[model samples]
Structures are given as structure tokens and as C-alpha cells.
Target: MAATSRPKLLAGRKVLLLADFQFEDLELMYPKMRLEEEGAEVSVMGAHPAGIKYTGKYGYPVKSDLCVDNMSTTDAVASYDALLIPGGFAPDYMRRNQAMLDLTVAMADAGRVVASICHGPWMLCSARRTDGSPLAKGIRATCFSACKDDLINAGAQRWWTASSCRAGGPFITARTPADLTPFLHAIIDEMAK
Candidate 1:
């Protein structure tokens, strides 16, 4: 007898996830596995030393498959179909890495889906366009309340939605872990495009 197979809506899609210490575990894991389940290739990259495990804010530890120290932003942007930034205090540390910032912008410019949740939008606030403007400028999205001002200062408008917000272009965002399921759905929808 033949078995049924789930539809691979995201087949051939590649998603790049940025990670660091204190990342929101659910925000990272949900998307990673969901995307994979839908047939997308997901790669985890972190700023920590190669092979070291980074702990999330809730004490969940996940090892990164790639180290940011040796990462090539250009190669990364060209290689992936989308980029994801998981929220937590990890964005506090990720925002300090120039390569991660560059890759975030490049991916957006390349017409790839760029999704962020909770405090993850912090990384987006730090990214810049080729013309030196803020990447988040003019994007309409919702994020954790604490990061609201940063996004506003970056020229983004507030979107008061409980679920994940999927704006046109390469932007998708959510407010917190409670929005994870919807956020994952948004990413899949965007990549399927």
C-alpha cells in the first residue's frame, strides 16, 4: 500500500535563522521545524564560537550549525530564500555584529522573506540599506512593546495585531511567543510566494 505525503509547499526554499545567547527558544524552534516540515532548508547561524551551544532566555540550549565569525554576508544573502530573527535578549547581542546586520539587509534587498518576532525586530532596526537608510524605515509591523520606540524611530508604523503581521514585500513580524504558530504560518506563506 502507498502512504500519503504532506504537500511540500516550501520545497526548495532556504531559510537563514540568526541566533545568539538568550534567544527566545520557541520563536526559533517553531519556525525551524515548521519550515523543515514544509520542505524548506533551514540553517542556524550564531555569533558564538563554532560548535558551542547558545542558551535561550528560558534555559533551552540549541547549537548553531554555522558560526558568524567565518560567515560571508554576501554569500549568505545570495544563498538563502529568507531570513528569520527570533526574539529575546539575544537581539541585544546580535545587533552588535556587523555581518549579521549586513546579511539582514542584503536578504531583504534580494527579495527574500524576512521575519522577526518579539524583540527580534531589534536586529532589523540596526540593519541598513545600501543607500544607508534604516531597513525598518517605513515598514508596517508589530513587535514586543518594549521595542516599539526603536521601530518607530526607525520610521516603521505600529500595527496592533494579536497574530503575526505579514506586510507586503519581504517583511513579516509578530509580538511574542504566543504568536509563534501564526508567525510560522506567515513565513511559510511568504516563502511559498
Candidate 2:
């Protein structure tokens, strides 16, 4: 008997997962499962090539798929249909990486869907757009309130606070992991569009 291959809903759609330090475990896992459930190919990318273990706020370790260094931002951003930035301390770590920021900027500029939750929007904030503006400027978005405050204080114009909100362009933002259901749904919908 031959083994059957997994069905591919996102047969040609590739997704890039960016993580580092800590990220809400459930937030990352649920979307990965949902996307894969619909046949999207998901690849995890982080700072280390050996794979970084995701820890919760409490420091409990979680598994990762691949390392960011192993994959080039030029390649992943260009090849993938969308990019998923999970929130937590991980976004803080991602913000410091130039390659990650560039890839995010490229994905958004290319009109590909860029979905984020919790603190994930920080990476978006780091990517300076062509107009010398934050990628999220003038775009309605939501993230961990703590991070939202930082964006607002930093002069990120047009940011609005909400439990969950999807804003201008192909961006979806959620306040926390609890807000992931709608966030994931929006991402799938955007991919379909």
C-alpha cells in the first residue's frame, strides 16, 4: 500500500514563521496547526540555525521547526505567500535583527499577507517603510497593550487600541493569544483572496 501525501490547500503557498526568546506557546502552535490543516506549508525561522526553544513567560521550553540563519530573508520572504510573527519576548528579540526586519518590510511592500499577534507587531514597527514611516503607521492594528503603548509613545501615528483588529493593507493584529482565532481566520481569508 502506498502512503498518501498530505492534502495541500495552500499547495503553492509557503509561510515563514519568525521567533526568538519567548513567544506565547499556544499562539504559535494553533496558527501553525490551522494553517497546516488547510494545507499551507509552514517553515519556522529564528536567530539560530540549530532551532530555538520557545519558552513561555514562565520560561517553559517549546519546540521550534528551523532557525532563521539557515534561511535567507531574501529567499523566505520572496518564496512565501505570507509571514507569521508570533508575539511575546520573541518579538523583542526579532526587532533587533536587521534581516528579520528587512524581510518583513519586503513582504508587506510586496503586498503579501503579514499576520501578527501579541507583541509580534514590534517587528513591523522596526521596519521603516519607503516613506520614512513605520509599516503600521496609518494602519489600524492591535498588539500586546504593553507594546501598543510603546508604539504610540514612539510616535507610530494611527495606531488604535482594541481587543482584536485587522487594519489597512494585508495586516492582521491581535491583542493576545486569546485573540488568535479571528486572527488566524483573517490570515486564511487573506491568503484565499
Candidate 3:
């Protein structure tokens, strides 16, 4: 049999993985590698610029290539094709940063792909529409069970706690680390479409 030819499905695409200290290791690393495997340029952006390192919940360390502060300019956040928000205590901290919240809100308003998992929805809950409505309003989403009330209170139309993943509009969300595969596959499927 002849070897099969594979397409670089994400060729030329740019993805930004947002996180900070205490981010879930698997959720962050897996998607980063898989996105790269599909030929996308993946950059990790944090609260600080390049050279600042953040430790994951499990002690994994990743350096940020860009900071949310630098993303104040339109081009900084608008240039990316998608944004990936991994779960953990990181989202708790990330949501408190005005710049981070602005970036998330900008990406959502732009209708860009935003893939988040587990506690990742925390950041989503913190985002708001230009009209000042919660961004999660009427959006189908899934996240860690602990976040269900927060999601609903923030206005998620349907938040699935037991499901592996849910994709609605430009948002793709998953419940936990175990759901990472389908979570990312859902994202790849979205990008392909």
C-alpha cells in the first residue's frame, strides 16, 4: 500500500494559548502540541511578557511569549485565529486581570474561536458583551461541575457538567482533563469548517 498523504489542516493558522500560574498541565500541554502538530503557530501568552515563567498545577513550567498588557493594541489580540484557555486555578487569577478580560471579550466580540476547558469557563464567565451583558448568556457550554452555578448565573444557556465537550457558536468547552481529547478534536473540527 502506498503511504497516505496528510494535509496540514491548520497550516498558517495562529493560535494563542492563555494561562498563568497553576494552570492544569495536561489541558495546557496537550492542546499546544496538537495544534502545532496540525501546523498552527501556537503562542503562549500570560500576564507578563516573554521571559516570565509560570508553574502549572502539577509543577510544569511554561514561558510566556507575549503578555496581556501588550495585547492592549488591537493587532495584538486580533491577529490570532483562535484562543485556548486551559483550566485550573489559573483562570481564577486570569479573570481578575482587566487586560485578560478585555482580550477574552474582544475575541468573543470578534467571533473568533475560543476553546476553553474545565475551570476555563471562569474566564468566559468574566467576559461581557459590548452591551454589558454576560458573554456566556445563551451560549451552550460545559465545564467542571463546580462551575455549573457560576456559568448559569453568568448566563450560559446550557452548561453540561457530565459531558466530555460542547461546541456552540464560536466557543468550545470541556468538563475536565479527561475530556481533553474530544475537547481538542472539537476545536480541530471547528477550525476545519
Q: lDDT of all predictions, in order shown?
A: 0.85, 0.77, 0.87
List where candidate 2 sits over 4 angstroms from the true fold: 1-9, 58-65, 153-159
Compare candidates 1 and 3 on TM-score and give the better one.
3
Q: Tens digits of per-residue lDDT for model 2 on 1-193?
A: 9988765566668888776766777777788889988888887777776555766665656566776656666676678999899887888888898778878888888888898888888877887777778787666787887887666654554455644756558787778877888888788888876
Query: Candidate 3's residue-wise lDDT over 1-193, tens digit each?
Result: 9988799899988898997999999999999999999999999999877779889999999889988887663775558888899999999999999888888888877778989999999888898767888778888999999989889999897648547899988899999999988998998888877
Candidate 3 lDDT: 0.87
In model 1, the Cα lDDT at residue 170 comes to 90
Q: Backbone collision count in every prediction? A: 0, 1, 0
Candidate 2's TM-score: 0.84
Question: Residue pairs in steric clash, candidate 1?
Answer: none
Off by over 4 Å in 1: 1-3, 160-163
> lDDT per residue, candidate 1, 1-193, as tens digits?
9999978999988888889998998988888889999999988898877678888989988888887778787888778899999999999899999888888888888888899999988877899887878888888878898998898888887663534564657999889898887788788887887
Ranking the candidates on TM-score from highest down gives 3, 1, 2
